[model samples]
Target: MTNKPMVSIVCTSYNHGDYIAEAIDSFLMQKTNFEFEILIYDDASTDQSPRVIKQYENNYPSLIKPIYQTQNQYSKGVRVEMFNHNRASGKYIAVCEGDDYWTDPYKLQKQVDYMERHPACSMTVHAADRVLSDKKKVLSRVRPEERNAIFSVERVIEGGGDLIATNSMVYSKEKVKVLAPFYLNAVVGDYPLVILAALHGTVDYLDENMSAYRVGVKGSWTERELATSLKRINHYHDMEKMFDEINEYTEYRYNSALEKAKLGYRFSLLLEQGRFREAKHGEYRKIYLELGAKKRVLLEMKRYFPNVTESIRKARWKLIH
Candidate 1:
C-alpha cells in the first residue's frame, strides 16, 4: 500500500542487559504492512546493553537504527536527548523503553491507523500489564478509564488511571513538535507530555492491553530511595513551577501540586495511625514541601504530634532513671 503511513518507534536503552534483547525483538515483531522505522538510543550503557543493541542493529539493518552512546547519561537527561535526536519522517511516533516490550504484533498498526483516521487525535495510548522483574510476574494491569472515566485535566492532575507507559504510547509528530518542548522544558517529563498532548486535542484510548512494563531493576528510575524521591519531588516541583510560568492562568499546576500534597498527607496519616507494615511517609512529606502546599502542613504536623510527645516522654523517663 503506497498510500499507507509510516511510524517511527523511539526506544531508549540504559543498562538493561538482562532484558534488552526482548525489547528490541518486540519492535521487529510488528507485522504491519505500513512502513515503520525503529530508533534506539543506547545511552552509553555500562553492561551488555550496547552489545545487545548492536546485535539487533546488525541483524535488522533496515528496520532498526541503533545510536549507541560512548558514555552514560541518566534517564532524566537521556529522554530529552531522545526527543532532540529523534528525526522521524513519519506521520506518527511510538515509544518503548529497553525494559518494556510490546506484546501485540498489531500494537503499532492499531494505534497508527486510528490516529490517522482521527485527525483530531494528538496521541493514543493503551493499557499495559505491569511485570515484576522477579519470577517475570505480571503484577497488575492498568487502563486509562480505570483511573478516570473521563480524561479531564483534573484526573490527570490526580495522577490516577491508565497512564501511557513509555512502551504503550504512540504520538503524532506534529503534536510532538508542539508538545515535546513542553515535555522537555520540565524536569518531570512524562506527565507534562501527556498534559500538553491532551491540551492539543482528544487522546485515543485503546482498551486492549498492548505492552508489558518491567520494574524492580537496578539503576531504574522507578527504583527510587528516600533521597531519590526527594530529588525527584524537587524536580517535579520545578516542572510545576515551569507550568505556572508558561500558563499562569491554568489551575492545573495547583491541582497537580495539591494531588501530590494530598498523597503526602495520606501517607503521613497512615504512619501516624500505626500502619507500619505497609506505608512510608518520610518522603511523601518532602514532596508536599516541594509542591509548596501550605494547606496540608497543619494536617501533617498533627499526624506527627503524638510521635513527638512520645519521644519527649521517653527522654523524661531516661532522665528520671
Candidate 2:
C-alpha cells in the first residue's frame, strides 16, 4: 500500500489574515479518495494569519501541516515558492496562495484524475476567476475563451507569465527535481515552473474555473510591483531577462515565440518611460495595433494629454487594485 499523499497543497501567505481562512477551508472541503496534505507557509505575518493557521492546524492536525516563520524569508532573497515546494511530501503539488480559494470541492480530485490518466502531462491547470481583493466583482478568468486543450512547450513559452493562474495550477512533483539554473534564479516563479513542466511533458488545460485569484490585494506582489513607474519598468526588465535566459536555455528552439514576447515587453518599457515615438515605430508597430481600442486611446492620451492620462491611471489603480 502506498502511504504517501496523492497531492500536496503548497500555500504561501504573507499578512493575508483577512482571506487565509477561506483558503484553508477550501482545502478542508476537498472531496477526494486519495489522501492530500495542506502545507501552509506563513512568512512571519504580523496579522492574524498565523493565528488563523494555528487554529486550523489544531483542528486538522493530521491534514494541515504549517511552517510559521519568525522572520519573513521572501524579503531576504528566499525563493518562497521553491521553499514551500521542497517541504511538500506528495506525488503532485497544488499551489493556491493564501489570498486565493478553491471554489470546487472536487478541484483536486478532478485534476488528479486527469493527470493519472495522462502520465505524459506534467502539469494541469484550469480557468480561474480573477476577483477584486475584497472577493467581490470578478474581473476575469485565466482562460477567457474557456476551452479545454493541450498546450505545448512552445505555446506555453509564447503565452508568457500570466498564461496560467497560480491558484489553478496542479503539477507533478517528479518533473521538477532536476531544473535549470535560470528557473531557480527567476525573478518570477510560476512562469518558469510552467515552462519547465512543458519542457518535460505536455500541459493539459481543464476549462473549468475551479479557483479564485484575488487581484490588487494591498501588499501583494503584483500590487506593489505596479505601484510606481520605476517599479513597473523594473518588473518588465526582469521579465525581459527571464525571457532571454529561457531563449538561451532552450537553445533558440522557441526563439521566434520568445522574441515576440520580449518585443512586447520592450514596447511596454518604452511606453513606461514616455518614449511614445519609439514605442509606436518599427517592430513595436504590430503589438501596438493589437492593443484594444481603450488601450490605444490610453496610449494616445499619454502622448497628447499627459496630465489627463496620469489622473485616469491613478483613479483606475485605486478602484481596481
Say which candidate scores most in lDDT: 2
Q: List the lowest-lDDT window of 10 residues for candidate 2.
A: 137-146
CA displacement after TM-score superposition, residue 173 of candidate 1 (Å): 0.6
lDDT of 2 by residue, 248-321 (tens): 88898988888888888899899999999998789998888889889998898889999998998789778875
Off by over 4 Å in 2: none
Give the residue spans of candidate 1 off by over 4 A: 1-5, 75-85, 146-150, 160-162, 224-229, 232-236, 242-246, 249-321
Q: Which residue pairs clash in candidate 1?
A: 143-162, 144-162, 147-161
lDDT of 1 by residue, 1-321 (tens): 654348888877778888888887888889887888888887788899988888888888887787777766653455544542356667788878788888999998898888878888887888898877634688788666653233555545456223667677787878767544555565555566666666666666778888998766666764442223355455445644655543543535555544563565455445445553344346564644554556455444545675675566457434432
Model 1 misses residue 300 by how many Å?
Answer: 12
lDDT of each: 0.67, 0.88
lDDT at 234, model 2: 88
C-alpha displacement of 278 in model 1, angstroms?
A: 20
lDDT of 2: 0.88
